[model samples]
Target chain A: MTSVVAQQIPYDSAAPYRSLSLNTATTKRWTLAEAVDGAARAGLGAIGLWRDRVDEVGATTAAKIVADAGLRVSSLCRGGFLTGREHGPAALDDNRRAIDDAATLRTRELVMVMGGIPDRDLAGARARVEERLALLVPYAAERGVRLALEPLHPMFCADRAVISTLAQALSMAEPHPSETVGVVVDTFHLWWDPTLADQIAQAGAAGRISSYQVCDWLNPMAPDPLLSRGMMGDGVIDFAAIGRWVRDAGYRGDVEVEIFNATVWSSDGHEVIETMKRRYRELVLPSLVG
Target chain B: MTSVVAQQIPYDSAAPYRSLSLNTATTKRWTLAEAVDGAARAGLGAIGLWRDRVDEVGATTAAKIVADAGLRVSSLCRGGFLTGREHGPAALDDNRRAIDDAATLRTRELVMVMGGIPDRDLAGARARVEERLALLVPYAAERGVRLALEPLHPMFCADRAVISTLAQALSMAEPHPSETVGVVVDTFHLWWDPTLADQIAQAGAAGRISSYQVCDWLNPMAPDPLLSRGMMGDGVIDFAAIGRWVRDAGYRGDVEVEIFNATVWSSDGHEVIETMKRRYRELVLPSLVG
Candidate 1:
């Protein structure tokens, strides 16, 4: 029975590539079906889904495609912009739609990019995130989805995420059940933080680490910082150290490669995946299993 | 005697303009002599000197120029870059020169920009900063100069400052006497920190507020993040709120305007000073007095 099962699976779960997952944004040119097929063919265990790509195929069809390819969804791209003035009935409805999609797609994690401040009142903007997140917590819990708060680098505090540190994200997640509200341990956004190791350990102890996103922080950040993330080995980020921190913190999950660089986006998706696999094996895998 | 002193001074010592200072980098075109004349002509009681500008006129002559113009040096631009691999006896010698220059210029605050990591070892680089900082503590103390640790924004962590937060700097400075080591409250670098208020209060209670530098954080940052600092009102920073925090923290010292925007640097120096005064009055003075 064991021999037959090994033959049928065609790959070992212990292999580094098996833990290597692709985030749809890395090969943004690929549609959901294409990403799913590519990830499966590359022997990846999972794929992180961005909302727009999932929307393109429809959540049900996207789920079917992943299931058919034997790949699970590692996480849902995002579901927060609570600080925007447009928040109202439409905002909650949109978040609920994301939660529903996460459940349908069979992913427990929803990455949250808290919106930037609408004005100079930074405190008020942060307060809104807390209030709105609390409102969405119960809804997310019912769907068995966790809102993984992603604290973007402080450089994005004005226009992307007001929550700019793991400490802040962890504090925000503490109020709700760890299963319902969690945090993302994204290397690119977090490597520079002085208190990250402690925070990651704290998150792990509380079981609040919902996603582990990997990418490099380019030394000379791109002109548009939103697209500054590079392939794991292309930037200055010390991935091995951060990887060790994450691994030691007790996280054993899909290691999703999520690059937002224009150069990577323009490259062939297969080649990009091949490079990611090699980089992951060289720079990150040791932290996990070594 | 009071009336005679007021007549000789030609301005009220308690006036807002009296505390307004011009950091020479804001007027990069000006020589030390020129900046001193410009600052004194603008009724600013103090001027922040950059090392390069001081080198041009020689520190002694520059000191005389400032004194002759009835202006004092508020703080020196920098005196730390101890983490560079090139650091050796020469690095300590250069820092000693800076300490000597600070004493000669009659300024006690020596802004210390902790150097960026030389390689991928962030923790190692930070340890080097701690080690080098300790070595220079007694040197600076002997000269009656306080090494004011300036935590640049994390965006500059790779090329500029490894010290990226007031909390980190405070922790690093904890072992030293508050008078020998201090921290800068620069709005441009610190406006986004959630714990800024508490840190500012901590710095104040410990009497570690060496300098309160003011500049706005530009929203769409320039390609070179180093030149992104803008005139206070020209950007999104809530100077009044931040200013109030500094003032309430017991910092009643000179408020220096230190912009590095290309536009500001190319503008007429006198006109720049006039605008700085207006913005400081409208945006920051209330925090100090109201």
Candidate 2:
């Protein structure tokens, strides 16, 4: 992967604050406190919090930890499994709790991954998601949180999220106010989409893009598809193109680096953050925030 | 998996000649002649040929064996790795040879799997696929063979086929005559598409459907994603729904079951065919050919 870290990059160094954020999942080995410290040490503008990490230190303490580190909470990792039939009530209740956590963490964006189908009824599951999202939308809005619908890659259509395109997320969010319901544009999940350019433009124009998650789609995907995301530039993603699209859409938000690869997780968390900055500056930010 | 096979099925058995087909990949342990004989013995109307098996016995004898068994060649497995710059000339030559073989086999359909992008340029790779297909159109037309564009699942967009949607396939085929250029409707690859119903209708209305391939998508996909395909009804694909879509679209064509699962490949080839027939009858044909 270091091969992608070339000898001569266009930019030798990034600015002190490039609106860069570190997602907790990228540093699997680090605790919430440690991740916050690492982000601050790396001079990141923000940090994306995973609920699991927040729960470990309690939401209030986690918020304090990030605030003390002087890093903004870019987004909450997740808050949606609304497609479950038997777990319907539990899922709804948990999402409310997640909204509470997001509110406590002081992050407006609560990334939602609509659950996959339990049975083969894809359309049915999707309808349930829509219905469930309607129920959660009001509650989330009450908490001043935006339930950011994350359109996972089509690969995860059956197991993770039935919603598989930025357009679908945008359409679902269309009924609600953009501030209450918005979309996440994750590079790993959306880079393969044929209509990505148009969809990115649409997302931007509609003022519905809530989160911008950066992670490259590994070419020879890891055995476990979930952990297949690589550090930016380590995979064959044209980050510059996608970054430019996001940038042109009039979004000046925190770009969260969220690598899910085992190798990235096993590496030194601090070093990974530095590498993330270098790669983001070298590849994506050049077109994005240049 | 047996849980899917209810004792009380809608149909006790399939019709004698149901236009059912068996792709060689399903019975990976079997040779071309074995697959043909197995398909014939199972009362299938056709058999989908893989180039590897055809190469094993040579195309002439392979064609003779299939003809001798009184089974039609449904379609050729593939012939379109036209994205490689280094292998561009060779890929075109090999595709022409595949067209020749398809003609010799007396099947009009040569399933073209548009190759993956070697770099991060998805748009560039897709353009090349469209361009390379243009070069093969006349050659295929002369031999009465149609280069059937197979839109692989988006998951394989990087390593397998860049054409990941039926709409994309149809767009690529729009510039060419339907008789010489066509689209493939594979349930496993296309079941996740939100616009599948409309695309199927479009493909059918345009008479662009060259093949209808079937295989279930396993939920907890296998370690080797390529070998993760499951038997019909054993996975989460709503075959009945897709079948009706194709049927309503006016595609009165052979239904080929092309699985690439290690378990299916390791199992008894004849038994797998029997299971495929039963599943097709119970799950797909109930709405498809009923």
Candidate 3:
């Protein structure tokens, strides 16, 4: 892997793949260094880092490696799970740490997967998220780390994340400054929303879109749809239409390709990067503005 | 099945199970006559009829059996796949026939599972549903049959129904008189909605809640979550919470038990009804008006 990494081609930020960023979760098996080098080799401008991968090498070292490789860290994978009752204080502390890490990595966005309901109280769980979010706003703003609320698909609302819509995420982000609080527009989770176009426009008008992540939603979703995300154009989603919505919204940020399928993970890391680049070009690049 | 029909216990309309109805899909293998008998034997006053079950014995014959068995048809299972562009006229004609069947069966509500996006044009498909619905309104009104739009869970947005929220269904119903066009509030399809309480209130205030179907959403969903619905108390849904919303919204309608899992269906039909009654009494009935 290191041999492959040393000989890798460096990404050109001013080229056609300028905005393409590889989210580490897309190739879950790669080490942080390998991912940075792989993204650079694929001519991808940036990479989205998951905390566990960053934690493996420590945030300070991970940041240096990416910077040395001439690649930007587009966004940290996540930092919010503020729905716990007994673990509320602990959850807040952990999120504070995530914010600190994002600051160190020099990434503006920290994606937040608001945790699921601890009990049967979905309303209460969401309320707690709002309460904790208010508390963290100042801390995040000071570090220039925007908390990007991600509304997972409704299927995970029971035991995963209660935030299930872009509108809900926007509402959660409304009171804070856009620089400190923003939303992630992930196609895999939100493409089914009937009001998607309107909401994307709203997110854009408010300057709250912190990141744009791309992945396909497979039908007959894997036993766990959580891992069913495929490469763009592999499923029923119209990436072109959704991509146009994100672009028209005035978002000139990194467009990350994030997938979680088991099959995609089993393939050689380099092969996966090649496929990701192809899918991004054919299915997504045409819809994005340079 | 016919032999059991004669010895079946008669349902008492004034009893606790007066508003309890059995959707034939719950006991998928049961014939129309058997379902009528099973519901009556279980002291359930009504049964929901699927078109195929009604077609098994002809709608007229099915209607007579339920009437003779002292049971009411709470609703006719379907009548709306109006999303097909090329088959627009055929879809409308089929829905017209379904309306006639609902009227013939003496059930006021005909549940409409609006078809999914025909192509990549979701907005256009939904527009087609609204257009065809306008054309069907007069005919449905003449027969005193209400077209009840059912918003299936978002998972089914691609291949099943594009209507994925109660609010969307209500919006579609807004143009017509409540008695002619209404919506079905099925727990399995809507348990994850954050604005449920408000929407239920809106549905009731507008007199647009045509039916209330109960079925729990499984967590580690079966291969097909479409058929993963469980008996009440078997899944994570807070039925007590959702049921209260429906009751407070001024709805005094049939509470239909509609399960679709293979495990439930493979059980003895009578045994399934017995379990359904027990679960309903424990998990859902208490939430309704005493």
Q: What TM-score would candidate 2 get against the native?
A: 0.94
Q: Of the pair 1 and 3, which is ahead by TM-score?
A: 1
DockQ of 3: 0.48
Q: Provide DockQ values for all models, in the order shown.
A: 0.61, 0.64, 0.48
Off by over 4 Å in 3: A1-14, B1-14
lDDT of 3 by residue, B154-219 (tens): 988878898999999999999999988999999989988888899999999999888999998777
lDDT tens digits by residue: candidate 2, B1-290: 00110011122233634578899989988999899899988888888999999999888899899989988888987899898756478889999889888888888888999889889989989888878889989888778888899998888999999888899899999999988899999988889888799999999999888888888999989988888789999899999899889888888778889999988877899899889988887788777755
Q: Given candidate 2, what's the lDDT at residue A128?
A: 90
- The sequence of per-residue lDDT tens digits that candidate 1 reaches over residues B1-290 is 00101001122336778878899999999888888899998888889999999988788888889889998788988888888775567888888898888888888888999888778888888988999999999988887888999999988888788999999999999999998899999999999998899999999998899889999988878877888899987777888888778878888778888999899989999999999988988888877777
Candidate 2 ranges with C-alpha deviation above 4 Å: A1-16, B1-17
Candidate 3: CAPRI quality band: acceptable
What TM-score would each prediction reach against the true structure? 0.94, 0.94, 0.92
Error of model 3, residue A19, in angstroms? 0.4
How many residue pairs in model 2 have overlapping backbones? 0
Chain A, candidate 2, TM-score of: 0.94
Each model's Cα RMSD: 4.8, 6.8, 5.5
